[model samples]
Target chain A: MSADATQRAPQGRTLSAAPGSAGLARRAWPWLVAIVAALLLPWLFFDWSTHRHSGFALTMLSEIGLMAIFALSFNMQMGQAGLLSFGHAILFGLGGYCAAHTMNAVKAGAMWLPVELVPLVGGLGGLLFGVLFGYVATKQRATAFAMITMGLGELVAACALMFMGFFGGEGGISTDRVIGISLFGVSYSSSWQVYCLVVAWTAIAVLLMRLQTQTPLGRMANATRDNFERAQFVGYDPRMVRFCQFALSGFFAGIGGGLYAIVYEIVTFDTVAAAKSATALLAAYIGGAGGFFGPFLGTIVVVLLQSGVSLLSNAWLLYVGVLFIVMVMYAPGGLVGIIAQHAPIARAGRLRELIVPYVRILLPGAFSVFGFVLLVELASFTTIGAAQGKAFKIGPQAVDPATAFPWLLGAAALIGGGLWLRLEARGFRARWDALMADAKAKGVML
Target chain B: MEVFLVSLLNGLVYGMLLFMLASGLTLILSMMGVLNFAHASAYMLGAYFAFTISQYIGFWPALVLAPLLCGTIGAAIEMYGLRRVHRNGHIAELLFTFGLALIIEKVVQMTWGLIPVPYRIPAGLDFPLFTVYGTQFPAYRAFMLLISALMFGAIWLGLTRTRIGLVIQAALHHPEMVGALGHNVPRVFTTVFAAGTALAGLAGVIGGNYHVTEPAMAFTMGPIVFVVVVFGGLGSLTGCFIASLLMGLIQTFAVVLDYSVADLLKWFGFTVTSATPFHEVLTVPLPRIGALLPYVLLVLILVFRPRGLMGTRDT
Candidate 1:
């Protein structure tokens, strides 16, 4: 059974009740807020120096939007259907290849397709492959299912490398996204314009995926995930539900891939590699696969770390691996789940009581994170960095890792902060329990 | 004929190495239900550990010491890491191992640097054993075969003869029942996990010298080992052996075959050209397509026969 299934009670039969407009508005507001926030973000990071928009911010935001779509699509399998796929990137990359080909065709005057519809072309490509591969992949459940997906992933990845005509071998296929065509009198040249396209598509993809979860098919997928034998007894073919979910996920992944192709104007074998698939898995799982917008948040955080943190340290992947392992072991609900766990306390207005405890833990937590990063950086610099002539710098002070003092300081900070954090965490947990008991006494049941 | 014989012998050597890795994996998968993504990482660790140890104490001592160290590390991981994450279900366990695989690879890179180490065969075993027509077969490969055959015998004896082995055999099929019968199931789990890692380490000790002992060797060998285990049929040692040998032979022979689908089309009197749809795919030589055969075979087996060739369970 899925991890989330044990934590929550089985949802009641509310599928038959039609959602009222008020209920619809309650659901729609989050998307509205998201859309408004996305539109306003580029402006917030505008650069006034060169009189040009912030290319870095726009590109990063665009990447975040694309990755969000990818992770959300991945969640359809993992979070909803309980189908863990290691080959979802196949659809995304296939979609990208299709979009790239379409762009080339348009540039060659062989086709008159609008740039806006290219993502749709990518989705179609994803759907085609999803149906083809899903039939074989969905035949097994649990470990077998995971293994089959991995095999398919490897098969497609190998094919992508060998079949140079379409995949373009190692260098991959590149095309011009501009195409000299105007859609709504906006010539697509600037990174900002591409960011607009990504936002629009990401919103559509997210809304569509959310709507999908409300449908009977979506509920059936959850039913299948929870108990396949029970789902079978209820006259539903679990395989069919899995197949549909897998195909739909492919379509969304393809849309994400389409945006990727459009933004970069190139698609490579790396786009469809196992590493890219792992990224989707990491983002979705870390963000909290149990919630709708969990993957979106996870994607933004991961992309930020991938872009921002990678700039400062070489041990960024190591940090991500540690973070992912920590999440899996301790917080299976992910970052979103942790926030949602405190929803009742916030509603009961008892959230203020936890502030002191949270700060107590937070200070030590920050210190530990800093200390851990310092140790990793010092080790990395001494080994790999020094070879490349890179020096470790903190503000105005440049510390040489070869010196015994720096090593002692790093070790002291890490050990000291780690011990302090552990102590703080225990106290915080105790205080949290007290707050929970007080809230329960007040009849604010959680 | 010479090419065929040389390839066959080479394939057998490679197959035995694969079986050493897959046998351990098959046992772990049956018992734990985890794919053990870090299995190959353990193998890589074995290779690296051997390289480090052999540098100081020579190859003979390193062979025994490296695998023992790997087994201890495996036991520690199971006791601390896997035991902590076990309550989250198989997916979490799998993810934990996947993360561990990444961390291991990174750590390996950090410790050894990102390049192939000179972990070659010992000077005593460097010479060729015999000449097959014009081709030479190395004594080191014969040594690998001898080591693997001894391991196979040892594993077989330990499983059938010892009391712990019998308990492990029982737990492999019906773990809960064994646990209910008052056998220390968790201890058995740790032992089995450690043994599996040790076997992988042993494979690495020998295979690394035959191949290159590089940081990326884990990733390069990881998928192929999975293919062997899956193709052999989950939880069946005999099936794993057969699948390993078959895959090894197929991969070896495919590299020697230069023909393609276009050649078959030519025999059928079909005039194929560049204008033909899927022309590239048809005309590609089998040798060039060798890298894809295992994956293709894996998919076909999973789709057509989910139980694998000799698997009793539905994998």
Candidate 2:
């Protein structure tokens, strides 16, 4: 039915990166730019006096890189095949364990393997398990598919905790990343060196995933997603398509996990936890699961919110959850979808026409958002911060949550700003509709 | 034998709680085709609300009011949230609920803090009810059973005797046709969802003190309830009840038995020493892997029988 919905809304942009009329370079520029940006990111955070990158910045960037792969792989099942897997971390974590174990084996002098290609070992591990699990899980589709995946995830996580021989129990398995076996003689001792590996692998994984969408397997996946019965009628086994896509997605997820094991020098049961799976889902959905690069973009933002925002406030998850729900209800297309939706107007030279309307909405939107955040943070502070002996302060003044003043100010701002935003949103919508109409009349929008 | 009896009694209490939560989820999953991921979150909310209300009022009033408040919240979520996402399709709706679950957890944290609240068993029911195998069974367990049994009877009477229940039953089987017959199917959905959540809330009110009233409780209990629903088969209340009890007994027995496949194998003359391949799995105790059993059962059932026992629909 969801597939049917997507089919009905086909404005022929299912394959947004149409190979026709566009040169290869034009289509490839985004990747090129992204790669350059990623390469320079760590250096921008480098400390000249210490001759080192800020460990936090490097770690965060590396997380975004690998998590981008993970989130994208999650989308392979979700957006591509219309299969919602609740336990994607089964593959990701399994891959990490395999990679970690292999790394340990190398350290123990049992096997000689390049440290650089460890992600492939992880990929293989993921593929094998994906094949095994996908065989069982792909037997059912829709809701059942989700349930089975969830069960499988929980099963694996439980196993990870119980099986100390492999999972290493609560403390988890840790390793030194300076496994001197790289082709380039890169010992991978430094965090910067590991970050480079992450960047390279992330690039490869992203490129391969992008190319996968242009392949027959990818098309069949989309075909099955759009209409399962029709795909079956067209002599394609929707089950087989789902199975292959599931396995391949696992391979990519495993690669991400492999990199995770390397970057962190450990893989814990947390890798396979249900929360880990939720992270992928959050990234993919919030980024807008519709586009190839949507989840990739979403992963970057989600990881930032997770790693960066948590520093300032204990209510980061609340922010992410609120953002997620708001995105689901209002912007189902996600960040990528939002951008894709506006591409036509941007191309039509009438893009500037939306500036006034946008300003009208942004002011009140900011006001309400600020109020919401303040309220949420204050609420969180009373419970967590106050317990930790951290007082809620406004510059020189310490604010008390038990007092009525802050609460009233927060409530008043929230209510007033919400009403103002609502009023302005109406006008914004009208203006946006008119612009869209004008653009469509000018043969700009598809 | 004493251990068996005590575990059996304990399992019954746990099973009853699981059924209360799974019942609502089974209804939502089997009928509406929307898995209410926040069902357990609603249960958590009930505990929180009950705890706060119990502090101000008392446990008895809190028990009655908490579920009602949860039901109201469920109704609002259905009307405002699920209704909007319903047009987008099941995946969107699922995501919406998933987001709701996360939000509920965060909200619970923000409001109550991360610590477990003092939602304890009331003094009246805190005493032991009876001696079972020389061990006293707490009166709280008995109270849980009594409440659940009373709830079951009420639900049975209401559904069997009322016109609205008849409409709901019909709508469950034939939602579109029922809608065509001038019944508000969405309203039925809202009512059922609210009822289901309220049931979960009621379970929380009873079970929270028995366990712990904490935000993490929702997540810990969420998956097991799901496993129950899937095992019981979709759209079948009878199957759900049976599955819930079966899982409860299995989980409880697994913990108490202290038996393992290693022991069984040892009886069969195959010693599972550390020298043996995969010794870790072969020698692991049942209690160690108790958490894995329900999920293992779930996957096996899903693979072998898409439609659970007595299931009308292929889940």
Candidate 3:
């Protein structure tokens, strides 16, 4: 995650055009359209798509929204604030537990408030916990900070299981969201209805957090992150900046957690587990931690990979680990960095000229992808499927996995496709370089 | 009294096991500046490896070979994976280790299956050692104590008496200086990492049969090991030892005692029922909340003393 931001520092700094500049305006339109499309997605699915209103979409959407919030909140620390938290899920879980208890209280007639307003309680709960935890956590930065956060998270998670009053014990606690405020005169009985709430909260949180990046506090936090000694010499307390940022990030995470509680209507120990913390870390890292939207994009990609890929392979985590390692070592800026690398080309208005090259590259790429997928599927079918007492079939042919023929076929495809892709990539790069050189000589920027 | 004595003995045994894991972790962490989230996973691998090897050879042979296998794996990881990610800085290094941890878990699960492997004590060491205040202490526990003590002594000698150990001790304080002095720092790192992982593996080999050798064993033991490492401080071996034993004792003793917060409240003339707001907390006893005690101490230590007990520098 830090890799993305660190790499982008030189890029973002050197290219610090004004926010409202023409170049910026032109570049921002796609993002604006993307956000609009995202917001209008449920409506599009409800009205047009055949599989729009299925339970899967709603669940996926809820997951995306919650994780986006979590990732963005994580970015506040990792990207803007420069704190690498290994266990940011403490605030998320705290918010969840608080929301659970609040809902339970409401159910028991302890407090009367609309469900829409109840997330505020959760947010505040998170904010308070963040403040308390952050005060100590921010006393030291870097590795110490990471350790403290991890320790706190583990401690809280354990407490949640041990102390039944607050954490609801192992059985967890459930609440009803149906009794909450009627947004647009609609009680959230369905996942789609709940999605509306999620979208609204996600938007608000994202917007507010974006605004925070524009604030002096956020800028100072970045400065402090870049060079703490320099910041201290320049009359700013780095610790205070980190502390405030930690609390704010916790607030956003808490809001996300509240949304989680509302959607699931039940919160369990898994909600606050180390795996969840790792999820936010993965999402933020994969999307590219350089920009506000990087983590959001990462969350989408990760969730898609998580839900989509996990179904196909039990070794999905293995793939994720490999991806993370590769990204850290090679593409430090993640997907965003890859995109940002094309800035020079994009700015010269030569983006359209690369279409042929992209297509040329796509042939081997598609083959490589197919070969990889086949190998993964074959392996999964042999190992996991075998364990589950399932077998692979080809119409009337139920091939035995123990056969050498299948293994050889899979291996051949992988090797052949990989070699082909390597050759193709080299050819494409050579052609592109020649074209760019010719264009430069001809004085045709496009 | 018997319960208390038994709990103390159990806690001491657990603490010693924790030390074996945490001491190596402290060495690697302090010298190389890595938390090594996979340390417990290495321990788990040790257990699994022993279980596999013991199937053919004897338990005693498996004990020697399993840790060596684990140490080699650690060396491979440090050389291939970690060294490559090191250039990206500490966070990347951490993430790399974390990813390694996940992959290892999945791979172990794939190889071993989800069920707990019954890696029992050898018949020679299966009997009770003695009775402590009417509570029997198993021969295996005594064997564990002896082994840990031997490991501790060996580690002490390696650091104090041998040339390579002296190089490592210097590297612990000034890694770059050691490198400049012509002692291979990377070699030292590999050795320390291997040694640490070997310790963890050895602990797992012993604790596996003492506890259970399930795939989920890593996750269960991971946090406690971390707690011990943190509590012991980042660089200090003595601190690690004290912290490990303290944590072990606390957890064990807590599990033996059944008194809860409500018990204290009752003594203060307060009548409590299920309707109380804090009834859940009050009803849960120290023994039942044993799992939480380590984390609680970890947090307290982190908040109050971020450098940890006897740590020379902040982690």
> Evaluated with DockQ, which candidate comes out highest?
2
Q: Model 3 chain A, poorest ten-residue lDDT window?
A: A1-10
Q: Candidate 1 on A348-432: residue-level lDDT in tens?
A: 5678788899899888888777777887777777767778877788667998777887777767777888899999889989988
Candidate that would win on lDDT: 2
Which parts of model 3 are misplaced by more than 4 Å? A1-32, A39-52, A100-112, A348-389, A393-398, A404-446, B132-134, B266-271, B275-277
Q: What CAPRI grade goes to candidate 1?
A: medium
User: What value does DockQ give for candidate 2?
Assistant: 0.82
Q: Model 3's DockQ?
A: 0.53
Q: Give residue A13's lDDT in candidate 3 (0 to 100).
A: 50
Q: Could you tell me how far off, in angstroms, the CA of residue A160 lies in candidate 3 after the best superposition?
A: 2.1
Candidate 2: tens digits of C-alpha lDDT, residues A245-294: 99999999999999999999999999999999999999998899999989
Using all chains and alpha carbons, the TM-scores for the candidates as numbered come to: 0.95, 0.96, 0.89
Weakest ten-residue segment in model 1 chain B by summed lDDT: B106-115
Model 3, B16: alpha-carbon shift in Å?
2.0
Residue A197 of model 1 has an lDDT of 89
